[model samples]
Target: MGELIVIRHAQASFGSDDYDRLSDLGHQQAELVGAALRDMGWVPDRLITGTLARQKQTLRGMGFDKAPEEHAGWNEYDFHDLLRVKFGGTIPDPVQHDRKTHFRTLRDVLREWQGGGVEGARETWTQFSARIASARQAATREGAERVLVISSGGAIGQLTASALGAAPEQMIALNLQVKNTAISRFIFTPRAFFLHEFNATPHFAPKERAHLLSYS
Candidate 1:
């Protein structure tokens, strides 16, 4: 049997010029996750991440001196571009909108994409989902008993949801709730993979570090 840990990248620099980078708190969160892994006596035999800067930075912040294997498949879907194309290239400035509105719009956009309503997408929903599946198939190949993957919420959520044969809405819901630096675990054997846990924040305890817990 093999085990896989899928970790969402910590809080990114949302509303910043470069949203791909991790925030300061995100670095702290990444370090805490590394500390928690040490506490649990868990040492991953393999590491993987998307090409995104936030994912790479998080891996480095977790005490790794070497870079993990990078896969573009694990990269997040372009939600900003999705919004633009869906809205006929006239996207409303997100800064003017509240969190609720943003999320609500995201949810609707995701649904539209899933329903084949999104035109001009870089990749269709089927292609995006297939990319994630391919990443998993590659990661779970033989010789790896424990694998750690640092990815964005969308990729992690989609993979885990598919593992459980979840409905489309359930997958969307999972994506929405993925907290930064949260760990989602899976049990994998030669034939199958089962979700063991989702959205776990074992690192943020003791009240003071509670502020480190973030979903964005």
Candidate 2:
């Protein structure tokens, strides 16, 4: 059986001008997860990452020096742009700066976007979903027994939801709950793909390290 391990990129600069890069704590979290995987004797035959700085940086921090294939299909949807489009070209101050308010508003906006309510967005829900499917196909191709993929929460959430034959709203819920550097595992064959785990943070599960767990 082939195993596909998808990792959500570590915490990003949530309220910064450039949210595509990982924060200092994000790097630490990536390193810790890398160590945990290595200790578990889990090594991937192939490495893949979305064409985003945070995704790529997470892979690097994980101590994998191998050249990874870059796939745009795994890239995250633009939530900022979606928010702007949804609210007449401006993101509310509370949503922009407050984590609680941001996610609360994002949840509602994502549902609206999925239902074809949000206009002037770069990618529609169907298109975003399609690309994630394509990316999954590419990652699970024959030849690699173990594949590691680094992606953002939205793409990973959508992928996991689709694998479980779940509704779109479940993706949003999963997205909000995924912690930084969390691992989601899938077992696959030529004809079937099954989700083995979702949003697991074994690296930070210890009481001493629990404070490192973060969702952003």
Among the numbered candidates, top TM-score falls to: 2
TM-score of 1: 0.96
lDDT of 2 by residue, 17-88 (tens): 899999999999999999999999999899999999999999999997778999999899999999999889
Cα lDDT tens digits, model 1, 1-216, are: 999999999888876658899888998999999889879998898999999999999888898554478888889998878887878887677622456777889899999999998989888899999999999988899988989999998998898889999986677899999999999999999899999999999899779888779989
Error of 2 at 155 (Å): 1.0
User: Residue 11's C-alpha lDDT in candidate 1?
Assistant: 87
Where does candidate 1 clash, by residue pair? none
lDDT of each: 0.88, 0.94
Model 2 bad stretches (over 4 Å): none
Which ranges of candidate 1 are over 4 A from the true structure?
A: 95-97
